[model samples]
Target: MTDLSLYIHIPFCQRKCPYCDFNTYAGCEADYSRFIRALNQDILYEGHTRHHPRVPTLFLGGGTPTILKREQLDIIFEAVDHGFALLPHAEISSEANPGAVDQSRFETLRRLGVNRLSMGVQSFDEDELQFLGRIHSTGDAIRAMTLARKVGFENINLDLMFGMPQQTPAIFQHTLLRAIDLAPEHLSLYNLVVESGTPLATWVAKGQVSEPDPDLAADLYELACELLQQAGYHHYEISNWARGPLQYDGLPHYACHHNLVYWRNQSYLGLGPGAHSSVEPHRWSAVRPVGAYIKSVEEGVSARGYEERISKELAMAETMMLGLRLVEVGVDRQMFQKRFGLDAVDAYADELSSLQDRELVSIDAKRLRLTPRAKLLGNEVFAAFLPE
Candidate 1:
């Protein structure tokens, strides 16, 4: 049977960050309770068959899942337990903003079966935090980390961003050093992608803000990789690094199990407004508007706004693109032939030859993977998967 995962989206935030473009709203507490009820209803309506049992990984992602009160979280967790068959050792993770948590709250969540905590501590610099419109001060982030440790959180991940506006190498290095001192189990380091309609994008359009230079950003990325590597963190994926053995060993090694479902083209059900899901050939998403989602759910209806059945060729291309993100799960020669009925090496012979010639990829007897130098240019490598 194909392994499954669950993603529960909480779209409420205390305050929206200037750079964030996620589908989130402020002051939606009244609707939240009803939303949770509707979520449970929808889960039961979909029916939990033995063929596709409850997920092993339950990821509560958000605009800040920690924004929910302890009681609210309890209700959601209870519903999840009732609606699905949770594995005893399931990895239940919740994304938290630094300002949204405390020792007591962390303890409460721990008792509620949240085994992992992924904190959003984008940067350690006070000015950088302000620039990013984060709600918490740098001190609050540090305190949150300390408190998580004190509250007995064994698995913690820190989310950090680089390549922000006016970010200098020295400043980034300082942030890196501070992060290392904290020594979280996992780190997600991503470059800032300024989406249109965000405040940062507006500032850029008005000549008030400029992103860090590409060359400088590249330098910072390389430095981060080197520093994290020396700190005993494995650069497993392009952006994720972790210490020690794979936490979810039974699941995929490099890709986090929950996200791997997406990359590996497996089916999942997404709950909450603006949540996306792919169940086999079809892809669908709930209405992005919070009000509309609540209304539909109250009316005992699914809040679906869009749906599409992906073509076989498109799915195959996506598999290659997403699979290559991991350092270990390479393009297997025989597996590709079995799945797609085509030899990946022969099908994309020209592109493979070019990438190999450029030292971007290494091909052995059975598999193909990115070279260390090429991982930095992962986008360029993935672009080769696009149809010619």
Candidate 2:
């Protein structure tokens, strides 16, 4: 049986952040129970059709998965358990808002087989939190982290962002220092991108908010790289740093397994509205509207509304692009050859030569990786991989 990762989306949030454009709804009147039932039906149908029962990792991601009541979460877990043979030691992770989780909730999730908790604590500064329109205060974030530790969650990851309006190097450093003091198992440090359709975009366009300075963001990122490494965290992926060895697999470092599935270009199934799934060259996305997705599943239709089979050449280009995101591993030459039946170097010789000329990429016998300078300008190197 093929081992696959599972991504389950929860599209409900207590309040939507203006910077977020994910398919999420924020309101108290939505029928969560009915949605949960639809999710179960979708899972059951996929389980029967796919016939692959081995799941290495399961991630529940969303606007705020912890916003759902304990009972609703329970139903979803039941569905997962019934539909798939969850590995005994699979990394089951859930993304939670700092304001939405508590000691009891953490305890409940632990009992329900959630071994990893990723808290969306964008910043530890009160003013920054407010500026970002985050619902949780700095105090709330601290309290949530404390409760997660006290309730026996050792594998904790914090999601943080930089490059916000009014953000400076000093301010960002302060936030980084505070986060380091908390000492979570993993950290996802991301630069804030003002998505086109989000409210932040309107604010920027209207001159109500200033766009983040790219040069300053790069400086802050370099600072983070220096500090995190000094703090004994391994820079495993482009934006991820992991500290001690994880419980599962006893590896010397920890990384988000579910996301690694994407970076490694492996097969995975995504369930729930607006979720995207890629099984090799084939990719598909579910209907974005919650109501439409639920209705489709209930009427015995596939939730997927869009599908495409990626050409072999496109897949090879994608493999090079995604695999290079791993800071340490880079692209495994032998593995690439096994998958595509061609030498990566020969296939993209011209692009690689240009990139190497620019000091953007370094290719050794075993793998190809981004240089320190390339890490700052990753998009330029990745664009070179695209078919001209």
**TM-scores for the candidates:** 0.93, 0.97
The Cα error of candidate 2 at residue 35, in Å, is: 0.5
lDDT of 2 at 301: 79
How many residue pairs in model 1 have overlapping backbones?
Answer: 0
Off by over 4 Å in 2: 245-252
Best by lDDT: 2
Q: Which tens-of-lDDT digit does each residue in 71-178 have in candidate 2?
A: 888888888887887999999999999988888788889989999999999898788898788999989999999998998888999999998878888888888888
In candidate 1, what are the lDDT values of residues 218-289, reduced to their tens digit? 999999988988997877777887777654432223235566566566678788889898877888999998
